[model samples]
Target: MAHIRERSLTHPVPELRGHGLLLRPWDAGSDAEVAEWLRGVSDPGFQQWNTPLNPVTDLAGARGSLRARAENAANGLSASFRVTDASSGRTLGHIGVNEIDRTFRVARVGYWTLPEARGRRVATRALVLAAHWALTGLGLHRLELGHALGHDASCHIAEQCGFRAEGTLRGAMFEAGRLDAFRDVHLHGRLATDPAVDLK
Candidate 1:
């Protein structure tokens, strides 16, 4: 297949609205935003399948982490968004299209929902919106999603967002809470041309 000429991603990534959810950039200065961010990152559920490079254990660390994500978006290296309710504006989760490669027209996507937002398909809705923006507005040729093996929820969300199951990546990521331990990852990918899946 011929490569679709990719376009440059805009600085200050645009907010995505749909599926009754809003995918917007993290507000580093807002106290509420920072608090919610801290809560999400510090949640035990988040720590289960993922190990962040720079962990956020407190409010200060949350602010710094949010700043770093904003910086990454500014540098065109990645885009991280806070998932929220479109109408209520309540913080629901976080989703990011990271490790963007402009030359290769590809990027990896990841996300987590807040405990209060669990069991409502919040992550699935957020991923669908983010994937659409990354593959369409950002003009990426492909998007990849990976989760620690056994993260069934993440695998389901990827499939719901049209990301096809590719294969297992052995020891692809650091095991939760331990850098020395390695965990297998289930890798999934979606091309820009792939048909969209229903959000329901």
Candidate 2:
């Protein structure tokens, strides 16, 4: 596979703005950001779909998580963004292009919307913004999105973002709360050559 010669991300991550939203890097020093991060990770809906390797249950954990994301961005391994309302500047969700493989020019994507933002297509809009940046701005060849099987909402979002359903990954992810248990994942992919998705 042909890969982009430049693999590392820029030191200062650029903000993605469009679709009435802004996708910016998480700030670890902001108390409000930390608080929202705590609420987002601790949300029941988020927990139902994602089992983060470094779980965040409190303020300290939330700070650590945000710092880790910063480190990853600096090292060019990932680009994580806080999805916020452009006009109000209120955080609505999280989206990230994770586990980036520079050699292959590919990465995995993940996202979650807070309870208050669930009904407004927050996740979908965020994914669309992130996907465009990952493919074009970041010069990645492909971006993959995987959700635990039966996650219909995520499936819909992936489809709307132009990530084609690729295949099923068996025993691919840790079950909701159990690291020892595994579950199937529905994998989706969007290549740089694929047609762009229309934003609603």
Candidate 3:
């Protein structure tokens, strides 16, 4: 198989502001950010939904994860951000556009909110903010999101963010637990031509 190198982003990822949230790059040095990520990855709900594949066991691993996120953005493979409360500067969640195909102008979006931040529509707002930036700021034409079939909350966040349910992929995702176990995933997508739904 031939490897194709796509054009990378020329500029740095910018900070995005929303109604009550701020989307900023992950801070590898911030204690609060590290603690928040550790808390999130430890939550049962987050572990089930995100299926991190590998566990983040300690603060060092969490910081390493953030560093890797920065490298991915630098290489233009992905752009990830920590969603924070604008007023308190507390980490609320995270959202990102990964698996970028610059040649095709497409990417996959993913997000997860901390337990303390759930039920407040944090994921929806963060997703909307990131998707808009990808579509407009980065000039990407398509963005896709997928959730486990039974994850109603994720589906709702996708829909509210203007991503239409495209279909399902049978056994497309590997859920943690049993070896070689996979779960069905419901796919959703949004195009550049799609009318942006108001997040306010």
Candidate 4:
């Protein structure tokens, strides 16, 4: 597989409308918003969307995470972004495509919206935008999203975006609080060829 890192894509801010949201790259410096958003996330199920970086309880930690994200992008691994209100541009959530494989044109997509952002069709719009960018702008063939089976909301988002449910993983995650963290996630995905998948 040719490494996706070799593709060297310039992250583009994608525009998605019709569902009252916009999906775009995280601003050059958005640590404050990142930290504040993380703090506001009080649900354990939603928090699983992030990697197991040490918990960020302060702005400094969020800054550190942003720095690390830049480093990762430089190394050819991930690209992250924020989901916002199209009209107001208020940061409502964050999402990203990670573990990119250029040869296969595959990447793992993940995201979570604020509690206030939930049930507003924000995630659905953001995810579709990400997929559109991946399959067209980035020339990717496959996009995958995995969510703990228990997190029905996330799974629902993936499905609503036209990703077909694949299967479940077992004992693949360790969540916060030693709470029997197992990945056991249901995988949802689409290939660029699927007519329903927005490969535009």
Candidate 5:
């Protein structure tokens, strides 16, 4: 047996193009940009599901938090990227791979699309690319995709991307505000080694 160094990797820092959608990592000093996007955006659907970043003390606080996680890839933590438009570079949403396990070859998939980005099948395309990257570039074995029990669009996106339902985890997550207790979430998952017979 030998100890192997986990390969240091960088997420796609490109203007990813898929089905007319683009995704890229956040840029330096994007705090105001990200924050302003959140300003006055009233969508309970987004808030209930994704916990829209709020109570932002200042631009510095927001940037420091997001950037610190990106800088922590040397560890097993997670990092997120901005889902945006290729031509105009407008922010559409967010996506990330969390619960990274190098030794175990596993990670959790998570994403949220802006209300404007929904109904366009944009998530399906972005997630397809994410799956391709996760299974091939990241060398992951299994990926978990979870969502609040009532979140249908999220579940649909996961299933459309080939992730299979794995039953709900009772009291799995904590809701925001008022110190809410664990809430049930529907669990879905997929494995990299799932049969490739269809590949031509």
Candidate 6:
């Protein structure tokens, strides 16, 4: 697998601008931002939608998470970005493309927003920017977005970002519930050939 640093040494991760948001590489020096991200992930709402996951309990865990993200990006396995407020530069959320299959020109996208960022279409805009880059900048042919069944907000975001509903995978994911049971997943995808929808 080609590392993102190798690709970035040639073609760096582009700055993606959106309405009221800016998607950029995660900053390694921003302890406050990292802490905020940990808080967001710790939110019950966020945990509910994105679960069966380890929680970042403290500064050390947060640093470990950021380090892992950087290493993944450096190795080309994934590209992660921090979604920030355009004006104040407050960290609002995160979005990333993972499971990148260079041979197949495909990847899976995921995101999470802080409680204060909810209902603002922050994730939707970030998704558009990331997907656009994946399709054009990365020259990927296909992109996939999946969410646990019943997560209507995620489904709406995927649809608004031009991904078409594909199908459902039964017991495809696990959520951090009482028993950590597997849950059905709703899949959506977009092809590079798909017409771009006006997000304005």
In lDDT terms, which candidate is top? 2
Point out the worst 10-residue segment of candidate 1 by lDDT: 1-10
Error of 5 at 163 (Å): 0.8
Which residue pairs overlap in candidate 4's backbone? Answer: 172-183, 173-181, 173-182, 173-183
Shift in Å, residue 162, candidate 5: 0.5
TM-score for candidate 6, residues paired by index: 0.90
Evaluate model 1: give its lDDT: 0.88
The pairs that clash in candidate 6 are: 3-75, 4-76
- The TM-score of predicted model 1 comes to 0.93
Q: What is the lDDT of residue 145 in candidate 2?
A: 94
TM-score of every prediction relative to native: 0.93, 0.94, 0.91, 0.80, 0.78, 0.90
Q: Candidates ranked by lDDT, best first? A: 2, 1, 3, 6, 4, 5
- The C-alpha stretches of model 2 lying farther than 4 A from their native spots are 1-10
lDDT of 6 by residue, 43-143 (tens): 89877877636667777787778878878877778888899887998888999998888999999999999898899899998888888888887899999
Clashes of 6: 2
lDDT of 1 by residue, 1-200 (tens): 11222223555577788778877889899999999999998889999988988888999999999999989999989999899898999999999999999899999999999998999999988888888888877889999999999999899888887999999999999999988989999999999989877854
Model 4 segments more than 4 A misplaced? 1-18, 28-31, 40-45, 48-51, 179-183, 197-200
How does model 6 fare in lDDT?
0.82
TM-score of 4: 0.80
The C-alpha local distance difference test score for the whole of candidate 2 amounts to 0.89
lDDT of each: 0.88, 0.89, 0.84, 0.68, 0.65, 0.82
What is the per-residue lDDT of model 4 for residues 1-200, given as tens digits with 9 covering 90 to 100?
Answer: 01112222354333444356666555437665766555544455465554464665666666677667666666657777677786898888877888888888899988877777777777777777777767776788999888766888887788888889988877666654455454566888878887654422
Please tell me which model should have the higher TM-score, number 1 or number 6: 1
Q: What is the lDDT of residue 18 in candidate 2?
A: 80
Model 5 misplaced stretches (Cα beyond 4 Å): 1-15, 36-43, 51-58, 74-76, 176-178, 195-200
**Tens-digit lDDT string for candidate 3 (1-105):** 111122344535678887688888887888878888888788888777666756788999998888888898988899888888989988898888999999999
